[model samples]
Target: MNRAPGDGLSAGEVARRLGVAVTTLRSWHRRYGLGPDQHEAHHHRRYTRQDLSRLEVMCRLTGEGMPAADAARAALTVHPLESVERPRTGSALSARAGGGNTIPVGGAGPEARGLARAAMRLDVATMSSVITRMIGARGVVHTWDHLLRPVLAGVGERHAAGGGLVEVEHLLSRTISETFAAVPRPAGAPTPRTLLASADEEQHTLPVEALAAALAERGHRSLMLGARVPPGALAAVVGRVGPTVVVLWSQAPATAAAGQLNGLRGTPLVVAAGPGWPRDGLPPSAARPASLGEALDLTLRWLPTAG
Candidate 1:
């Protein structure tokens, strides 16, 4: 698949254009057989235009959270000259018949259902576009609670049922994370007076990311110490920042050590969030906000206004 010298891109150039690390490209090459197809004696390998296109698909799909293997498989199927078109609304649903697999979005609306299908297909471009549009139209909280959460729950449910859409779950989570990160924070907003982090060993940080984005939407700011903050580190951050409000999140019971909350006793308003915490075991001084909406409300109320 080697092409003329001028028609190929070096690994670095491809990585730069694709917004991925060179190391990631190497890993994809090594693990998934998705490397430069052009090589010469005593010379470095170069990626053909087709190779670059395939890698772009790989990066987008994996960035959206598709498993590398699955993304690579999908990427390899594309012809070099073929344009990657956006998936049509409900197209994923229509394509699912006889596939013996589907993401159950429960009572979610068409958008959520469509998102679930897109996720199943590892359609990152479409997924991201859908998320961005939804956030713009419905606001972060509405999109999170209604569209994103339902699809995420369905992905989780399918995985729990042993149908195994781990790639879908990962891709959807990544897409949501990127969408939230893209939210525009207000200029001249006060320094972040709120600190947010996940409990130790709690890898689920989407809720907090959503909360941060939601805060940004309202012109509030927060320091999001994403996922798995050890108790000592958490305490050190609190001591250093002296934030007006500190929120700790945990996504599973195993990560919900009450001691983490207890360590933040001196923080003015310590809130326990997510479903991982035991109802009775939370630090007596900490408040538990039941949902993202409640958490956002509490954080806002406790956040000190900047001078």
Candidate 2:
């Protein structure tokens, strides 16, 4: 709802106003071919006030579950703030489900609702406070599993469909990962039996980073090799670390079933945690945690002395 006087807004500022990231804005621009009027040298992006206003509306609509392309077209066609809302799929549909599979914390007072909003917006400061509350109440592992996962899953569904603000999700993921990873564990904590890393072609590593951070908080050391770690490198790390539990995240099930699964070898327990994980036909040695909390539970069971 906020706007500056001039018609120009920096790429970072636009992302901040829209509650996303500069990189995300760039991705949207590239993928959907939407943008501000001009760019500075080196291909930096800039938006006029009209452009910013339109993008704001577009992001809002998309966040509410409209596809980015449709939202952009609608934003261009109509006044963004008008009462008439365009019918689109994704966020709007999920929101209209009246709080379906999302966190059931409807009307948990203004603070909780505000926390949810801040999270949805990817406000770093507010998200920090929210995470602190979650950790205090549910412990790091449970908070990650129950609260963060659902919210992020919803966000991811939106992003994949070009409905969610990609930058916001990226910012939130980095913020949460860093915050949780920094929390100290007791001395002499147990080492996890398994390690997890993303396979080649999987660009989404934030989920696994959060999972690793939660595991670390519980006194189980898990190395996060980051996105697109080569399967061969992973196999080497597994050989050296000898982790009992190995976790993999795939945004697409078909990709994992075909190629990413090549990254999973030698580990007795393999857990694939993501929306793309198969509901059935998983190998007996492999399992799905549904959320970071469930993954931590398995980690704790394997390393009972942790925490």
Candidate 3:
């Protein structure tokens, strides 16, 4: 059905369509000059088709982890003449010419190269699609170790070198998180016998997320407590849940306290994952997995057997 000229959707309708809060729409309008363009006598402002299109762009970009200001700017610049569908393979990263400043993938394959290019252009759709395809074909462990990790490390390297591409890193991280979350778990899998979390004061959860998805592929399940889980909270959850195995991840030395493992003293297996842990400081009972593959294998072995 074609929307007639001068007929526009109300704020509530637009919000429902976009899957955003009504207040979000108002804030986007007030902050970014993205409100309705259709004004009628004695009635509230209404969003025109063009206005909705711009808002769609804004929502997509922001959802993929672009800063609100940058997303709004990109939204404003989107013309009605552009195609509304997801970008084609060759055309997605067309904005970047010559690939001079692209993210360094370091001997990775075409998929990683394409992902880096998409990330550099901040093309959310292409980045997500590429990641989802890779995960589907390669499974979580391979995709994380081979495709995602190298690109993420490259993004980190670039950011460290010049203090730039923070937005790109955020976008790429968000995309990876979403893709992992969308992976399907096996049917009729036993109740989760393992728990995964970031170490106390740790903010990195992507590795744990990857581990969870990998376990799902093998018909095992885990309870994932994302970023910055405190030591006390970890203890409380372990006591209450009675998980057979617990994996605590710390991405930096600052968050990897050996005492955190002490909190899980009674758990049958405590795996200290990530690089943050000091080699000598780990608890004698805790096992450390050096890579995603090793982590998955170790955790699977610790899962409870069916009676």
Please, what is the TM-score per model?
A: 0.68, 0.57, 0.68
Model 3 lDDT tens row, 1-307: 3454247888888876765667777776666666776556799887778888888887666544455566666887784323333222333222222315667879877677667866876777878987887788888988988889989999988988889898888988998998888888767777688999998789889999999888887777789999999999999999999999999999999998898888899999999999999999677889988999999889878776533
- Please report, in order, the local distance difference test score of every candidate based on alpha carbons: 0.78, 0.63, 0.79
Error of 3 at 62 (Å): 22
- In model 3, the Cα lDDT at residue 251 comes to 98
Q: Where does candidate 1 stray beyond 4 Å? A: 1-100, 304-307
Structural RMSD, model 1: 10.2
How much is the lDDT of residue 135 in candidate 3? 84
Candidate 2's C-alpha runs over 4 A off are 1-112, 119-122, 157-164, 188-192, 258-265, 279-282
The TM-score, computed over Cα atoms with residue i paired to residue i, of candidate 3 is: 0.68
Error of 3 at 182 (Å): 0.4
For candidate 2, give the lDDT: 0.63
Clashing pairs in 3: none
User: What's model 1's overall lDDT?
Assistant: 0.78
How big is the positional error of residue 232 in model 2, measured in Å on the Cα after superposition? 1.1
Cα displacement (angstroms), candidate 3, residue 43, comes to 45
